[model samples]
Target: MLGDELIALLGDRIPDDHARQWLADRWVPRFYATRPGGARVVDLGCGIGESLDLFRAHDPAVRWVGVDLEDSPEVRERTRGDAEFLTFDGAAIPLPDASVDLVYSKQVFEHVERPRPLLADVARVLRPGGWFCGSLSQMEPYHSLSVGGYTPSGWTTVVEETGLRVVELRPGIDAAALLVRRLLGMPAFADRWFAGTSPLHRALRRHPRLRGGGPRVHNAARLMVSGQFAFLARRPED
Candidate 1:
């Protein structure tokens, strides 16, 4: 994801209309292009299921499955209308090998104790040439379960080590908004409170001083503020 406009909140956080727009404008357009027609999609660590719901709305013919450690009513209610829910044992996924056309995750990598095994399992489920893309924290504040913080370089190493080729890796930030937040001494608040569509926010981020250097300067600011990393990767076709 590039530019401030492409930065998106998850479906669980945003309103349904915004979620739909995110799928139409961001998610579907990028992820769907790599998979075949009627591709099977599975989301690992799907928290409340709204992301899958939005994806389903866009492509009804695709098979949608959401997997997590616990299957709770809240998740069930959120996902029941459009998708199937499954719970896993925190290790091996229950699905058949090579059965999924795309496997997606977001903000879930840090808690994975055995990241290689997790990626191996993800690779197992994906068809050759299929995609697995998600966002993860590069430098976020620690929560109880938070155990890893990875740089873009670290992600490239981990994914390739697990047999997935990196396609795109970039900073996750509303660049201008984050800078404003940093200046206001409330970087954390900006993540939750910044206006996603503010013209000034977009303009400041697109300014020459920052935009001209490409992601180098953009990501430097992101890392200082504990921003995130967004990656799109694939299982090898061979």
Candidate 2:
């Protein structure tokens, strides 16, 4: 009948609106808990070192490195102390082979013109069993220097080509709600739209037919119409 009614039919297949499924604050804490105090982390396309700060907040001993295309004024003005910043030619990362334990990027892939070489470098810089994790746009509006976004399959293909196996993919906020926020000029209050508990999700949760499936089906159901997606890829152990 209605959109929500239709989705409700896919009971147990609906994605959860929790922090773990959404990869928010829950992720950094769990990641650092397992990592060594001096674990090496690289933030690809880091903008003003926000993720680095998050990592350091969890484990101050984390060796943080921020990488971007150029040393922009904003980065120079804001990013300082503790973390190291580096620039690359967009394809090859400047770090040494297998140097990092974690490679983190956030909302930055949508702007990249070429991702294969960059992903190859991601694999190169990561130590064996290291992780490449981040979020990417799927159906969000065009913003700063936006090129194009990737679908779930498209992203998996490229990551797999680099010989890194994808272990996780979670849908972010639904596309319809994200469009609404953009249409409203993305007010500060509208930032809650990123919290994963969109109207669609709440409706699904309310549906009498909706049951808890598993992360696989739950994620697929949401990714079908999500604005963005988060992923975790791992380099195999030697």
Candidate 3:
């Protein structure tokens, strides 16, 4: 999560459609490349529940559950007719073991005070061959009550040390284009990252070498400038 003032300024710039687009464009193609179907997906730290709309309109096969520490009025209102929303005890999840196929979160890891237990739970709930896919801070100013920062290797190491295996790890952005957007004060441009609405980002998706992955994504030498760490890792099968 970013600072409050920054969120207040840029949140809406993150278009409502961007969430669904990011799902269909980025995460699903890679994480589900091996097991494609309506996965039992859980959104960890599901706040206002707006992410409930991230799935495709026609994909009713995908079951969604959101769990958070607070079941606020906003969260309740947004999830009124959609996914099941649960309130958690902050560390342990309530779901049955091996119950879900995918666990997703966005910028939620930093707020977690004890990541080991959380990751342990993630590993526990995920069905074998299931994935934990999402992004975390690599270069943001500490917000969301974060503990600290992590370089790309340090960040990935945290998850691997938890027992899950990293299958795909990448730098999250194309630096030159991002700089151009920031220089132009089109900070709203920041909202579309990894969602691939920008020309530069979209072009990356079409690359012959990068096909099947998401748009505006960079996992190569250019990753050093990215502000976040994005990855897909699976719970191994015996």
Candidate 4:
């Protein structure tokens, strides 16, 4: 179980629609709004650079860098010519201190075996007042395609311990719902259920609804029952 087999395994387990929505609505907008022109942004554990893609879409002027261990062919194909994607160890990013304005990661923290070093690296690379925006799966099944694992409270604790300020912590989709869907062998059902049959789907296609406070309230209710977590943090000004 390595390479493509591993990537496929993890990808299959994650709810695709939920992940995409998080990136487009939650993560991208949150970070990109803070960036000034020509700001350097690094997407740590970029996984195929989808998050980077979202950042690029938000602001094509911003410089984007993506780092990941498993640069799968699909990821390579998707990220080609859009931004810089590099293969590197997640714990030890290959960038100089205070070189970037933001470091964004999505669903990458739980898998870290030793999070301290990773946080140190993040603190090392980010400039004062730079943001480290991301999300982690706290209450989800144990599935890995890349070389990592999950841990609840780990991301928050690491940021605090490593001297980063906790800016905002938002609850994500329902993990229990996802688990049930997986258990029932129908992961896509929840998305269809939430989306319903609307002409909007034809326009957006596969992209999930990235707006509406109403949907967030409804999704939070579902998550309360399902048990999943997500958050965003930042490095303080010295």
Candidate 5:
């Protein structure tokens, strides 16, 4: 599929709901909470390892693995032996095929110079029915060696090419809000990012049409203008 056909096909996968509460960027914590105990979860581009705390708080039974280009003193200091840490060459995940139950990433894909190899590796590591979920940059400005952002169509094409199915896509903060935050050089404004109370979202909340339009209408409007997006995809069951 190509062009509008592919876009329409992917659009169908987005869920419809009444509250539009899923627009919140809280998927990481919620995802951790919902997993059955003992789920093998991988943190792709684990950074200084903040997510481990969520695992500890939400689902202690998760077998956590942190993957990055190399280990750091901060990561070692923060995470210690609580979870295994591994390094990668940006092309492959070291885990065996079908070994991971869930792979979670956040604001990391934009740094990836090439995504296919790592994504294919994501597909390789995920067990049948396993999920890959994370947020990606869209209209945000450059930061921390940023490479590029992704549109909904761009995400669908790249992720689906790796044999994972795109299940849901939700918008994040508004583009203008994100850029203004960056321009003002204020970290305090960062709180709005995943907090789900960004300026545009606040405005949309009061809009009568969005208030009553249901999830599909709300999300379609939001995704068109958001600065970031989160996705949930699965490796099909064998």
Candidate 6:
């Protein structure tokens, strides 16, 4: 099987954080490198707009448009003046054809009930040669509130069918690291361990070998087990 095929077969079982960071590390650089000067970009299914904030921090000049089904109060508060957010109807997106230079999405496709039409919409809004860089889970637990659909050939086939060409495709995060972080409650430790030099950070860092071991292990184990997928594709310049 191909790399993406392997990931599609096994991504969900891997750790979530491992998957998240893997995507962040890979796509952040690509976005920074390819982001056109002062161009408009769209972020679909931008949960809480944290990624939008990251994109803005990377390049403040770019205009960002964010969309999601529901907006939490915290998300609303943080997203204020940062980007434009729209509550979308399930079928149609409120955007013009060939208007955006890039459309970034993460973990959004799997939940879409009508994936084809949604992707067609994505293609409709993207300008020629524009790109769509994002990640989606393959093997994962089902949260009724946040449903995901994993199909190895689905994304590529869909994009090609929509008349877009696959530019670059890379393996995303694995599942093991995700599980460990969740079990360890690392999100709660974000401010404590990751942000500053706290005791927990020192403890984890001192063990040098232990510091970044989870993601590495997760990446390896995911290739062995099943549940991870990520890719970047683009529309032809035509």
RMSD (Å) per prediction = 8.3, 4.4, 9.9, 10.8, 3.8, 7.4
What Cα-based lDDT does every candidate model obtain? 0.62, 0.75, 0.62, 0.59, 0.77, 0.60
For 1-238, candidate 5 gives per-residue lDDT tens digits of: 1123433656666567532424323666666555678889899988887788776676777788989877444445654666788888877999999999889988889888879999999999999988898888889898877899998778888999999998888777778788888888857857656565577766776776655565666676677677887789999999
Q: Model 1 TM-score?
A: 0.70
Query: Candidate 5 versus the native: TM-score?
Result: 0.86
Model 2 clashing residue pairs (backbone): 12-211, 12-213
Looking at model 4, the pairs that clash are 6-145, 110-149, 110-150, 111-149
Best by TM-score: 5
TM-score of each: 0.70, 0.85, 0.69, 0.69, 0.86, 0.68
Between prediction 3 and prediction 5, which has the larger lDDT?
Answer: 5
- lDDT measured at residue 157 in model 5 versus the true structure, 0 to 100: 89
Q: Which ten residues in a row have the lowest lDDT in candidate 5?
A: 1-10
lDDT of 4 by residue, 93-160 (tens): 99999998988877776666667898889988999988887666656666564344333234455677
List ranges where model 4 is wrong by over 4 Å: 1-25, 70-81, 145-154, 192-227
lDDT of 1 by residue, 47-127 (tens): 687667567666768788888777444444553545687888667888998999878787778777778887889988898
The per-residue C-alpha lDDT of model 4 at residue 175 equals: 56
Candidate 6, RMSD to the unseen true structure: 7.4
**Among all candidates shown, the one with the greatest lDDT:** 5
**Regions more than 4 Å wrong, model 1:** 1-25, 34-36, 71-82, 174-226
Worst-scoring 10-residue span by lDDT in model 3 = 12-21
Counting clashing residue pairs in each candidate, in order, gives: 0, 2, 1, 4, 0, 19
lDDT over C-alpha atoms for residue 44 of model 2: 89
